[model samples]
Target chain A: MFTQFFYTLKAYKVPVSLTEWLAMLQAMEKGFAGNNLLSFYYLARSLLVKSENFYDQYDLAFREFFTGLEVPEELFDELLKWLSEETLKRHRDSVDLSSLPQHDWETLKKMFEDKLKEQKERHNGGANWIGTGGTSPYGHSGVHPGGIRVGGESNNLSAVKIATARKFRQYRKDVTLDVRQMKVAMKKLRHLRRSGNLLELDIDESIDQTCRNAGEIELVYHPERKNDVKMLLLMDAGGSMLPYAQMVNRLFSAANSVNHFKKFRYYYFHNCIYDHLNAGMEYGERVSTAQLLKNLNSSYKVVIVGDASMAPYELFMENGIIDYYDRNETAGIVWLERIANHFRNVVWLNPNPPRYWQHPTVSAIANLFPMYQLSLEGLESAMVELTRKAH
Target chain B: MQNFEQYCGTGDYIASRALQNDVNVAIALGRPLLIKGEPGTGKTLLASSISEGLETDLLVWTIKSTTKAQDGLYIYDTVQRLNDARFGDHDISDIKHYIKHGKLGQAFTSPKRVVLLIDEIDKADIEFPNDLLTELDEMKFYIPETAETVSARHRPVIIITSNAEKELPDAFLRRCVFHYIQFPDAAFMNDIVKVHFPNLEEKIMKEAVEAFFSLRELDNLRKKPSTSELIDWIKVLVASGTRPKDIGRELPFLGALLKNEQDYHQVANGETDTRSIRRPSFLR
Candidate 1:
């Protein structure tokens, strides 16, 4: 189930990981964790995501993977608004609202007021006007006049005035709409307020929207117990390893993404360790296996998966990379030995078949690690292995 | 590599068990193992990961066209012998004592066992595997002038990989184990994608991954994108500041992931104008 959610995110380019899945699972297990969510949101932020953010991502995962449910539309729309706002902030820094024409600005503000009114109406279940039974998507955006002394009786005039001013200020020439277009655009904007773009969904927006659709959970905020698990991944990157490299990278990224929510460390290694597989120079990305392992606390799990069979000496030489950077430095197998000692809960998943260990190179390398050669055909074996250790 | 717990794999067309068993057995026997597969099937990562999983030193000696058996092992200072000969009073035994440690010699002599990876052995001449006969079998080498045998304090784990461009000799192959690495199935590939590129959005992950998988066919392409390339694509997506929902520009970057220029051209041409392939309605 978690894998499905992970996959869904991967498919959409959301980049979910096993560690984050675990956290989401934990959050679900605990029912509703407001604090865990806060942490989860912060964690997702580090993924370099800003639109709907981690809250939205986690919400989508929660609905789809855990409860086997989907979030509601209203909440989803709120998140979508955030997504649009963030997207605009990211790409339209050059489009300053102060530079727009006065009339266009007024029209835009009026459009915004209409949108706010529409959202409030939907939130109020077609307009009771007082506090709605459920939480509003724009909880404190100052658009909705909650019963608590809003300093105005009948917010219609103020809403229109403020929204019109805001819209006018934010108006851009390149993003112009003619008078007739504005009428259509206003209707569309209202529609967006009520229902997001069904045709072209921002996946991140959709995820955020879907999450908002989940409404509010009975959230409890607190710190989670630190898990004694660190995941180290070794991926085959270039050459024959390249085809599956994306998969491996995604898997690693999934684990990394999931780990972002949790507090586990990870390491990356390339083909068979013969000479020292320098974790530092891998993918031109800076990470040192030596530094990670040395500093990493024990009580963690290490997993290695790859095809496992290469040239005969790939197992015996230094610098395991097929194409050496500068020198013919072969990665030594000693590197694996070093990593194995630091973490004991190690398992190897072969992207190859179990029968194929017949190859001397595969066998030779498999000899050193706790490996499970999984058939690439299904998830059963992988599922079994991943949980069997605990069972 | 064995002892993997955190490795998430990618793809949906994995090989059969017959190939994997060969790899496990070879690792157990400490024999020189040779792996074969098409490009992008993850041939090299297996060798490196095994060494990493074992926590052993991995020495990858990538075979070149000029690579020889001696290149697989250690290349002693025969040149230093001539250098020493520059002096009139060079002793034969003393010159032999100056034997420099080649990759193989270092492996055979080290206190700690090393993982020696002879990557792309097929790229070298046929003589490459023939040279491993003595050192691999007995784990020992003899210096003729010194008249002494340097045996293995520890036998380095040996793994050799080839893309099957050329078949090795019977004798050389007989000494090693073999496995054919292939693209993984969708489920496993999903796990793989999750493992490495954790921060990317799932929506694009699946679509782009499927796109990558589709490229496995179409003979016009030269090389297939590997597990590494997928991670890179994800990175590109993330770094390009694209939303999890937006990956329209991602097709052009496929050139980075696609191995064949023709395949890339095909994808580039078909995708650039088609707008639908580049930006599906569901995603946009």
Candidate 2:
């Protein structure tokens, strides 16, 4: 009988507390058996169930839970009368609270959009027409992104608008590039072109680096435009960095704009990319940065971008990007020069406030490489640093 | 509770009010209440506890790999008496007395409510549950040897626990009330821990609880940490005067909650943390 009651309460969304049951039994004056069947129901409700919809549910539950069993009506009335509001509310809410959880955008879209889409897709044979939204297949409208937009295309528009855009385009066919948008990070790569970064060649840097030498920095130079081109990008994935995730993401888009990533191929490092660059969650195989570098000569270009700031040793210590297992990854400078020696082309874009770039570690790290650091604000001014070289 | 509680911690078993109510209905109606749960969740404890609380004698008839019904009730006394009086008075009547007071006989004769804990009824081969139906339904067990069926004036409380290793025959299930036991949630575990270990630092206690539950939810968790293991975890913490830094070292020993070795290794290697996934506002 009680087994039935358990499923009974569960279905009704009434939580039957083990703690409450003990209390209820203690409060009861009679054995559960001798009590009228009605009283038993009331007693169980008072003890185990407290929800708003108990009466109807009890009617349903008692029929199922108490089926094939005969009990008196008096006990049932007592069960109904003594129910507390919480018990009733719980029962009523439990019916509705059938656990429809608040959904994230992905989850919400996943749940409804698929069903809606399937409805549309299955409506396949119907005539593709409006008012047909109620009857037709591909949905009434707005199903496709700007597909035959009611207001027309936002970018690729009608001839009238295209004409207008073409006219406007003539004057401002004027365009600019921001060096800071260079986010074409070799995300989750195992090894860079094995030798060095190829994003750009700082002929000025090679000269400066060679300044350390009497005449030449012994430039291990080979600038095979095919082989020497390289890039390294590190993106902060978690923590407070979440807000700028979209911005950081967009920076990557611009980075691709500067150079189509597929054309140049590259390496990835994180705040502490260290050796984990190989085993990053995103990596399937080691990207062989060294092998990538051997294929190129000094003509390769290299660029780096990041906010470049962190908690103490977040760049170097345990719990750093190096991953806890690898505390001894070569310094970012060591990795930088390995690539710099291969390709003279390199630029460091800092998303950090320009004011912060003067921070000691920032300077120490920036000075380590022959890098031209540009803040995101001076994006236009930073262009042509690359295009100028090619020209 | 029957000694079964020693095997199952409170966390693995929640005394179901519904089950208890059903047991009462069984007692009032002279029927049996059968329970089903995962093997480790302490179905045995429920039968045992109900028996104890009601001041009834708990006769645990644990179903075994090859158990037969006759094995539980009335083992013939002929062998014992014949051996003791070997080369002497071996009366046939004495054989009848020997055929008495096995699981069924003892249950029949006990003046108080005899709680027949048919533990793991699902374990025995098919014929056993089938055999018991007559005894369970009629409150009388037949022994062809005695030629007179044994009956109980006051129906002994019958409680059966099944692990559901295999599907049960419907004809057998229809006779008893059934309740299922699922693993308890954290709030339930917290109550259990409070009951199990009333004195411990609030912080370590809560952290220990969180750590164990997280260990269940994350870390490639395979099996949930049951109540008994939770207590053992708390016991380990209390003995060790837990330090925040030490959580890493000590958490792997809690391998009982995680069935897979990889989960243990991950926790050991600092890949898993009991910490919540909060969006910290600094990575940008």
Candidate 3:
């Protein structure tokens, strides 16, 4: 009945619900797929998989279930070679276990350095010398236990190889946020208020007025309700935050695209906010912290994104900022406290997970502001916290 | 069950076999066919193509960010009624006088079956698709003001397209047939171009397609040229009387292919290594 295929898709975390499963069955019953497996593959894929993000996982599941169905004849030679090599590796593993010389950590490090100095040309498939595919402990893909895997393919089953390759790791929702999802999350920060001109007619009120007037007709008008929420996003850029640049760019683009905000502004800072914040990510124009505090009132909801990973002295001590030319009389923590005190609703979004927030600077900043992880749930909760009535 | 006509590719539009199959399946099942793809892959054009192939009238409802679900079914023009009452120029007693039919209402009350194309449903609010779920599934909607229920005379073929501005609700997606139109490969692109320009020279076509694909292969292009762009570039080449051999050495009218300033400069500066363009086998 191919029920295992449904379970296989679910096992691969494809989010295939029974509704889609039944739809695919109905499509098949309607003779859309006919009897060919190729047509059936396309039919099932178009029905069961909703998003292209899950297409790769569905492909993996399909290959896992329908093994050797459409594999080319040319691959049989490679398959035979791989099978023989696997058997040879198994045979070598049983005999070579006793031959591997035991060396302690320091001795191994010293021996690797000595081998690097002694060896000159590239070495492959030998018992001694640092090279690839041999009994050597330092080289790659050989029979030695705890051998270092260098720049060579792993000799394993094709399924394991494909799974470990993880070609679609970036498409996984848990790994990063796309612009659309972030825009949806940002949309929850709306606070509607009737502030515009009274252009729309109040029909019910006009009807009530006319009914009360007995014979005369009257008209009523009301202002349109518009989103009045103002937001200020301060993001950490460059330095230790370089690894998360793409993710932060997605967030930035999402925030930029949500045009419903009354006023949306963003600025960039390094590890911590000090005397000034950069107007752009390239640090072209500078906006002083004092100037920012004077211009923007406490009504603006502030969301600061950063890793909060830095030297303790850089945050706690004066004249300890990492930028050599820019000196500050006030410490980074003091500036953070000033902003936190000025803003009624403020939240810190750490790209690093909560487990890594044990650093001294992170805890110090977390105590100053309610810190939340930069994720979908975290963003929703942070927006909830920002919209809550402040005493 | 009603007899539904099959949709083959029209003379203008060249659809892939899988797309043609999905379209036929959707028509037979009487479900909305949701098409998603990159910007210029002709997700919107497929609806018109289906209409043309099936020989039915096409009703397009272009959605915007401010579009509401109720606007598609019926709009109770209360303001017009109030104005009529104030001016004493028109009838205001009957509430149905001001009730106007939207695109969906028009499709439902049409004399003949039509193709309902909800273009770019994701441009509207995230809940927009979910709001139309009942109307789309049951092919009927109720108007509380007029105390009337409007159902389809004959079930209209529904087609929806999305740029993926927002993730559609699962309930809305569940009721529809989904298909993702992949960007065509080189051979497929050649067929598509020939459909547009049947009289194009063989040598010019070969050189143009080769240049267009290699330009797309360059890294860090913010917006890669698509099918529409390629067709425009080919039109420009044919009109300008540019030589086929000159296309490999100096790509004239590069603006039609690359729209981004960064992408334009990248190609113009010869940063990409020009792969050797071989003559087509037929030419030799």
- Candidate 2's displacement at residue A184, Å, is 54
User: TM-score: which candidate is best?
Assistant: 3
The C-alpha TM-scores of every prediction are: 0.38, 0.41, 0.75
lDDT of 3 by residue, A252-300 (tens): 9888888889999999998989999999998689999999999999999
The lowest-lDDT stretch of 10 consecutive residues in candidate 1 chain A is A183-192
Better of 1 and 2 by TM-score: 2
lDDT of 2: 0.49
| Residue lDDT tens for model 2, A1-391 | 1444566656855545555455445424334422223335534543443322233444455555432212235533332222211111111111211122333335533433344434422222122322111112112221211111122121212222322232222111112122222331222111223334444444566556555765433333433232223444444443444555555555555555544243454444555334434424244555555665676566544555555665546644444443544454455445545655655545566655567777655675666543343433233334334323532
Which model is ahead, 1 or 3, in terms of DockQ? 3
Per-residue alpha-carbon lDDT of model 3 for B1-284, expressed as tens digits?
Answer: 34422887899999987688778778877789899888889999999998999899999999997799999999998767766877898978899888999999999999999999999998887789999999999999999998999999988999999987677888888888888888898999999999999999999999989888877765446688999999999999999999999875688898998998977886677433345322232112
Higher-ranked by DockQ: 2 or 3: 3
Q: What share of the true interface contacts does each candidate keep?
A: 0.00, 0.02, 0.36
Candidate 2: regions farther than 4 A off = A1-391, B1-16, B77-86, B244-252, B259-263, B266-270, B276-284
lDDT per residue for candidate 1 within A290-380, as digits (tens), equals 6666766654555576777777666666544465663234255566666666665566767665787888877766677656643222222
For all candidates, state DockQ relative to the true structure: 0.01, 0.01, 0.27
